[model samples]
Target: MSVNVITYDVGTTGIKTCIFEISDTIKLITAAVEGYQLYIEENGGAEQDLKEIWNAMCSTTIKVIDNSKISPGSIQGISFCSQMQGLVLVDKNGEPVRRLMSYMDQRARRELKEGMGNGLKISGVNFLKLLKSIKITGAVAASVKDPVWKYNWVKRNEPENFKRVHKWLDVKEYLIFKCTGNFIMTKDSAFGTMLFDIRKGKNCFSSKMCKLLGVNMEHLPQIAGCSDKVGLLTEKAAVQLHLKAGTPVFGGGGDASLIGVGAGAVSMGSTHIYSGTSGWVSTVVNKRVLDITSMIASIIGADDNSYNYFAELETAGKCLEWVKNHLALDEINIYLQKICVSDSLESLYVNLYDFMLEEIKNIPAGSHGVIFTPWLHGNRCPFEDSLARGMFFNISLETGKRDLIHAVMEGICYHLRWQLEAQRKKIKTSKAIRFVGGGALSPLTCQTMSDILGCEIETVDSPQNAGALGAAVIVAVGLGILERMEDADKLIKVKEVYVPNTANKEIHDRNFIVFKSLYKNNKRAFRIINK
Candidate 1:
């Protein structure tokens, strides 16, 4: 009999669940979910209600199971793939002490500066520098201080909620606690908290950090790997989720690492590109390959042995959506239709994106003396400048919408290329790139990536749900249905490969040169504006 596996991706925007049949070959039976909204406040503070998030997860799980024809009794295990670095506080009775502090939340920025003293400069940037300075070593690091810093901020400010607090947990661990009545953290999720030491695969919190922040490490849950079974689902949780009691709950990793698995980018040389709300260029490394220049080495996989060098440029698809909503709302479908209408010829309809692409395509390899910096959401890897803003240099009235569009695309690709180039210096071999997420659906974008990166981009048959599928892979592995993760990888198939056109490569090369200089010229200007 085939084992039925259910996996959940607890994301910032919403909760997604997938049900898969695990036999000789893993098969996706059904996958669906509902979404939740994020609560944003003043000063770059973003948060989510834990109760609503958990309810959404449970509701989605129940919905998937209720809609499925397969019996729930056959489910062997359930696992999770969650957003990394969000902090949640709970009391002794397992009640929330405060609103969950999302990774995007910058309230900790003030605390980070105060804790770091005169050495700290800016808000977010200084926080990262202070994290590096502490040099905490472990697979996971729970900054008793950082969380407390944010927690105390809430206490001093909010007052009402702070007094009610008891224990603090990462979002993933908190979700597990809700389902299985267990408090545990995964290495992958823990590593992203800036509390963990990348050098050593352990959870080492510093006394100095603890003293400054006044947080006790004991309040944090024990840490484990993605494959490890955290606990069995309780009767209440099983009933609510429409699953059998005692189903194994596996500790899952961060979405990025699992995405690597979903894209079959698990082994060394395997590269995966996920372009959704944000865009990322990620590759798995057999060993830790740190890029001093880019700061791109992140532990992506559940296993401690491997690392994920991920570089991201925010607002790829989001930017396009912005354009569609603002500039070309009326002719959106017409533009989409034009993309498929002409296989042999260029599109006739001048959709905002197509118009942009055409101009970009015409502007030689590097946007023809035109350079665009895609710092729409600031920046993360390769350049961790929050003050960084978008720029277009060497522009003339001749620069059309097409030129601007292509510049945006090329600028994002340039950021990815910079990270990849850094990775190449550390890792001798890299594999063909696999494209996943909503952005992968765009043939033009895929081809453009190939043209710029000089590598074929392969996309899985189902790209949008790679993260959920990866969570399913974890369930399959935990249930002993698959002997190894690579077995799961083999069963996972790619739908198409977008090979790079040699002709377009030369054009992108010229544009890339100018793209690099745009940032150099505007870096000071960006800081000045921020100041």
Candidate 2:
């Protein structure tokens, strides 16, 4: 018998609702997307309205269900794969205490300093605290953007709201509560807080780390496995989503945990590159590891007794989105009008990006010495610098607009290669890495990534829905359609593969060296300019 499930892949800027029919293999039935704003404050604050996000999820869910012509009763379960590290505080009524504090928010500088500051340090974090956290969680929140620091910021700055906090949760946890009316945080989301005792089997929140970090243990919610059935759909959520009242709701995971599964990188030592709004290089590992120098760590995964050594870039496809608006607005507008004047063409922004990429395929690798940095919203992993801003370097009078465009893409790929190399330092990554995300929809991007990273790039069908597909897999496991999460690779099939082009190796190699130096050489200057 075929089983159908719904998954919401909640991203930084939007939510993607996908329906999948899982039987012998996973099949995408219908998908719908709705975008919400990431409200940016002047004081290094970033937030999203929980109501808006919830509404978007509801709207997309209804759309996908109606569009697919599938009986809503047939949907076995609903799950989510959300952006990690967000701070959402809920009260007794299960409503958000405040606007959701985004993972992009970096206003916790004061809390970060007071907690992990100057006296004795390791990798810029307090030495003793780092050791304790590494021992307990196998990770440390050296980056100010972590949920712990955000939790600290609210406690000190918004004391009244802090008093009202009933439970602390991440992005997925908030939605999971809204759907099932149960307070739960998936294990992967718990691990992302840098407070969960990875060494402990269950009830793993570490008192030592939480006490040292000043987070109240009472506010932590009960932990659930990624595929564990949290509860049935609440009557209110069912009405809003046009689904059955008692549909099972599963404990979905964070993007970092499940996107790899969607890309079919589920087995141990399987590596994948995800280039979405934000991007990362993640390798599934059997044992936990930590790299403080590179800000990379093997975090708990959705699968039992597994981990992914994850390295991230804050802005990957976001950089491409940036260039589309600022650098190639004219070309984009013209292309949109040529295809369809309405939002239909524009809604599929990846198509516009592919149109642009098609225009620059012949622009040569490395953009003829012009280089761009993918740090428009700052950077993470390898170097944690919010002051870092993007730039187009080595631009000469001879440089054309196309060259600049190509440079922006090469710059993004170079950053990915840099991260992949960092993971290689601790573990062996697959030579032919699976590249999945909206960015992977472009053949030129696949080829460019393969060329710049000097490896084969593999892509799967519906690459853009990899996160949601991964979530569907979790739901399938929960519903007994699949035996385990590890069976994900058996369902997903590779659609295409690209091999590296040896001819462009020299230029990319030379530019990548300069690209690596851009930060080290200019980090001090970046702080000065951005400050």
Candidate 3:
């Protein structure tokens, strides 16, 4: 009489599976997972072995079933949430043709250039104003890096693989096929590929961009809604994962969109910030507000009926890890302990982490005379430039780690603010920011974000696992266990809130001006150095 739902989150680093019972009281029975490696090749390209990831998914699913001590027949449905935009090609027999190209892969740079023609151009807005408005991580607007481009790359570079390929899939759809023996793309996942028309809720590969690349829309899978049932688990999959063969499978979405749902960020003007390996600031809109310039407006949430505008930063936690591993490897515990012990160490320090922390701490509400452009992996959203790199300006030896630290955090915040401003301008009612993902765990970071942005930052319960929970909620809806998407808020709860400290607002405001100027002042220098 009870319904069990199993959800899998195919993430950048690994696969996580959670088994839960859907009833008046939602209960998590068990969680399990297996890890995978991320391959980064030359020229900023990143990839993952599709077969290996699938194996991990299967392994994790079985592990969760076993851990839950529940029989396969008890599960009514299974669903997934996956990293967005990765390209996977399959043979006629539904076997992978090659390794999946990850969202981070930059091999499509040339394709983007050729597709856009004459560098990057915004249709109706000032390029500079647009750049300052959207989240300008090096990745956004850089070029056509969707599966279409990657598929073409394979066709040109590896003709044999292309010849054997029958259908192309994003990460989520591929995983669905592997589990349910169905080949379908969810609208939420397809929207991010740049191959779908967010406005019309249909595949938009026919746009000038696809024509330029000689891509056929037929090569991609048919798009479906997130709640649409693609198929039931096959006998083999059911037996292997301890689930019923006829168990329904719903089309899951990108982790970003699901995170929004899981965090109760369903209404218009509500923003959600996810900071894991990378970071993103996303807000839902009732309809498409296509800014001829600025941030990306992708179809997320339930369908093309709604829109999710995002300004993403590619490396927030990753940058912190880089500093921890390379710069202060020996002082990690020491620095972490200092947060609770040493008062002087709290005041100022330099190096990437220390400087970033301090500038975020002091620098008179903003980095008074400093700004940092985070281009560790290039920019996304507003200014799509792959060749772009990071920079810090107006630095003096007098500037200690505190100032630098504050500058780094403030710099990232400034970019987030840029995204918020752009979305607000287009949507007119955008407000409320919710922080999710791993970075949201830090009270200090959340407080800093609230102060710099002058908005309240709320951390949802289970911040780290919101995406996985979101996937489960989708499954619950698909299986007829939950009545509506909005009902999820009652099932989910927020754990904490970080309000702005007006005392630091003045300093943050001052530093924001410097942060805004870094890109302009250092553009030529960055290009030269990269050259």
Q: How far does residue 172 in candidate 2 sit from its true spot (Å)?
A: 1.3
Tens-digit lDDT track of model 1 for 1-531: 778888887776778888877776667788776777778775656788988988898888877887887777878888887776677878877888767887656455555545554454433334454445445532212222234556556756787776666656777788888878987778776556444445554454444444445556566567777888889999988888878889889987777778778877776667788876667778776765544346555564765567776666655565665555644344545563443336433446435455444444455555545666767656666665655667777789787655666666667777677767766766753557888876676677788788888988888877877877888788777767666676657877878888878987766776777666666777898879873
**In candidate 3, where is summed lDDT lowest over 10 consecutive residues?**
132-141
User: What TM-score does structure 1 among the candidates reach?
Assistant: 0.82
Which regions of candidate 2 fall more than 4 Å away from where they truly are? 200-203, 330-350
Clashing pairs in 2: none
- Model 3's number of clashes is 35
For residue 403, model 3's alpha carbon misses the true position, in angstroms, by: 6.9
lDDT of 3 by residue, 1-531 (tens): 568888887888888888877786466788886889989886677889988888888788778877778888778778888888888889877788888898878777655545444534565333552343232211123344556567667777889888888888888788788778878888766666654554343343335334444666667777788877988888987776667888888887888778888777776566788877777878777754555456466455664346677667776666565544644344536563444425556464423344445334435655556676666777765656556776667788787655665566656677777666766766653355778876676666788788888888888766767787888778777777777776777787667877788897777777666666666677777678764
Ranked by TM-score, top first: 2, 3, 1
Give the C-alpha miss distance for residue 199 in model 2, angstroms.
1.0
Number of the top-ranking candidate, with TM-score as the measure: 2
Q: Write the per-residue lDDT of candidate 2 for residues 374-480, one digit (tens) a residue.
A: 99888887888988989999999999989999998889999999999988899999878999998899888899999999999999998999999999999988888
